[model samples]
Target chain A: MAKFDISNIDRRWIYITILLGALLPLFVPITFAPKISPEVKAVYDYIDKLPPGSVILLSFDYGPSTLPETEPMAEDIMKHAFINGVRVIGISLTEEGALLALKAYSNVVKEFENYGTIRVNYGYDFVFLGYKSGRQAVILSIGEDIRKTFPTDYQGTNIDDIPMMFNVKNYKDISLVVDISSTNTPNDWITYAYSRYKVPVAVGVTAVLAANYYPFIQTGQIIGLIGGVKGASEYEYLVNQKIQSNWGMKPKRIPAMRNMSALTVAELLIVLFIILGNIGYFSQKGNKRR
Target chain B: MAISSSIWVWIAAFLTLAVFSFLYKDNIIYKMVEALFVGVSAGYSIVIILKHSFVPNIWKPLFVSHNLLYLIPFLLGLLFFAMLSRKTAYLTHIPFAFLIGSGAGFALPLVFQTNVMAQVKGTMLFAPSHYPSLGAFINALIIFIGVLTVLFYFFFSRGEKTNRGIIVKTGIAFIMIGFGASFGYTVMARLSLLVGRLYFLFGTWLGILH
Candidate 1:
């Protein structure tokens, strides 16, 4: 180990370490056994249990800023739903999320294109409702009437024209509302959608927002949570495993699972830094006492 | 390794690098990128709102459908533009008040039901039969206790300073743990963003690590 005061270590050195930790794994990947947590499993189980043709409304409540963390979640959940015959209705409460949702859905659909057995058609299997203002209002309106909330899909196709949306009207049509959020949009969903309408809501949020939902999750207000990238990795692992077993499909190492190596290494470096910092503080304090 | 040939990819890579350049030191490139980001975001957002919300929700309904009820919100929305005029700037406050009033009115009951009543149910409905195991039940019970103590601390914090009980100390402990967990997540978030950018530079632009 290098002999240097961690407390007084240059910020650039720390940044470089993080950069290296992140960069190295991408070039030469290393992955561990993805441990599935109960909360995440709860979400997976809920979706898995939904009968074919059951609709899941997934909200891309995040943008480019938190895309790396959240985008994987969207992919995992949508893939699971698509794998089963369960349909999905994509929506975004945030403006940035609207296009991002479409992009994510497109990417997932592209991946599904590889599998000859799996087929997902736009406006039939899934629909992206695009962005709407008034987060809570939008949620409540979806509860009352989804068609009124989103008259047209992202591609400007009328809701009535979409075959899948023929029977879809409100919360009753939606088996679950999963919000992948970087912001507090999940809280709004829980408040307006879950609490008011008694709709089941799950959340995949940025790491920071995950902790804030402890009370909600504990109360069973939000049924499942994909906390952060770690949670996403768990999901990717789950999907990969299931698809491999049931469908005999080759496992595609999804982004979250792929990035887990880098994340682990980076997090380890952070832990090392913290340890060094504490040691430096203790040594300094001892010297002062002498 | 092949570099990205598309002009758009090149532009994106350049912008991503320009933003990352701040890690070394602040420079004109970073500043320019920052300015461009803010300006573009604001402009794009306004366009999106108009096309998605204004045209479809308000304008089409009021004009095409001949819905008189839509006129109320439309008129109130018009008041927002008054901010551009010094003489009529006060009118902006009317819409602001209306927005706040209605939003609060709409949210009050739902917010209460979710945050308070639901939380109470979670804390109270700690039946051992609900748990899969004793350990899970205990964990739930601990959380149940922590909730009460934390709430007690919050309510008591505004009062006298003389009697700081054991419950207050426990509450402080829980609060500290919460803050610490939040800080850890914050670190994770920042690092996640970095990993994403590096992925873009290496995987997308450089085409080495895809």
Candidate 2:
């Protein structure tokens, strides 16, 4: 057989392969049914069971750098809340996340409008409290008084003027707290919100950080977690399932679902590269032995 | 292929391609976009910090709301800039002391409650009689063993000869498995980001995919 060499393979070729793996899937649509993990299910079930008009706090704690992994989870969770008639109180602990929070809200609200059934009015049904400094201090203060921490919403509108803020004074009024983050904000939430106020906490984090939070989940400090794109896809699947079953609504195609095929292709390419590299190493070792 | 009509979409597409060009080789386009991104991000962060945090919490409270108590924090914050001046740098120490002291004091109890006590409680292998199940028993046992082994692996106080026990070997295995899983998840995370960018290029900017 012709000599098989992976060691000398051009790096550009690998890049092209990866690019193709990511790009081709967009042209040929493929659907992936995510195996919804227990953690993801817990999040879905908790939000699903919340009473109508219950206030849910969403802390967007990521920047544009993590938008891909974080945004889908944010969108899906917001959609679920809106569909379930749950009031959303949005906040961002990170400066970069402030714009992202608004974008996520706007995207979900636009999609919700397409349903033409549930009307969501800004400052009434939902509000974005925007970014705050003193990360841990802000979180602790919010546990005591949200209005005190955020005197006004993102648009410079007074919190007192917002109808949704009427009952939401602190974590006491909130049903659940979901933080979508690329950093250690979830840990802060667990330490401050859950440990102190006994508020239910959930997190949607990048996959790399997901493993670190399992200990928190095991301790029941975090009610649920949705990690990275797979987690986002699973959540999207759950939300779509709920909307379909409850309202008999047609499920809209979400970004997470669309991008999963590309992820699969990229993963397969990586695996292939790993196998090839190993084969090359072994083959060279055998030659040396000769 | 159908192209986009929107000027913003074209701009986004151009920027995406410019950034992606770094995969082949770094060029002026990539450098320009990178600088633009950094400049925009820094400028935006300053604006947001001023509008949301400083204005609402410090400025408005001090001036508009006339909450005199806010002046303390306001002054402390201003002292942060004092570090730039050699003469006034001593003032920075006061705020730094207060910050470090208060932060540690606040975080101490909370960290102990969540990270220490809660983690220890979660590692308890002895299950209560009410929720007796074989699966739970096995899972708890595994977790308990894993935690101990992992901890033992990091115990460098013991001599190498003493630490070469079967328990240490098992700890190595568990650590390896943990590392492998982390590696796998990290790969997944990176691929997800790539998929996201491709989707944006094709689905959003190009509008060729549905």
lDDT of 1 by residue, B65-143 (tens): 9999999999999999999999999999999999899899998998999888877877874579989899979988888
Measured by TM-score, the strongest candidate is 1
Error of 2 at B181 (Å): 1.8
Q: For residues B30-53, what per-residue lDDT tens digits would candidate 2 score against the true structure?
A: 999999999998999899888777
Estimate candidate 1's alpha-carbon lDDT, on a 0 to 1 scale.
Answer: 0.88
Across A1-290, the per-residue lDDT of candidate 2 in tens digits comes to: 97657776888999899989888777887778889999999999999999999999999999887787899999999889988889899999998898888898888878777877778888877899888888899889998888778888888788998988987888889999999999999999999999999999999999999998988887799999999888999999988888788778877667887777788888899999999989889988998999
lDDT of candidate 2 vs native? 0.87
Cα deviation at A115, candidate 2, in Å, is 2.1
Worst 10 residues of 2 chain A by lDDT: A250-259
Give the range where candidate 1 chain B is weakest over 10 consecutive residues by summed lDDT.
Answer: B155-164
Off by over 4 Å in 1: A1-4, B125-130, B157-164
- Computed on C-alphas against the true complex, the DockQ of each candidate is 0.78, 0.77
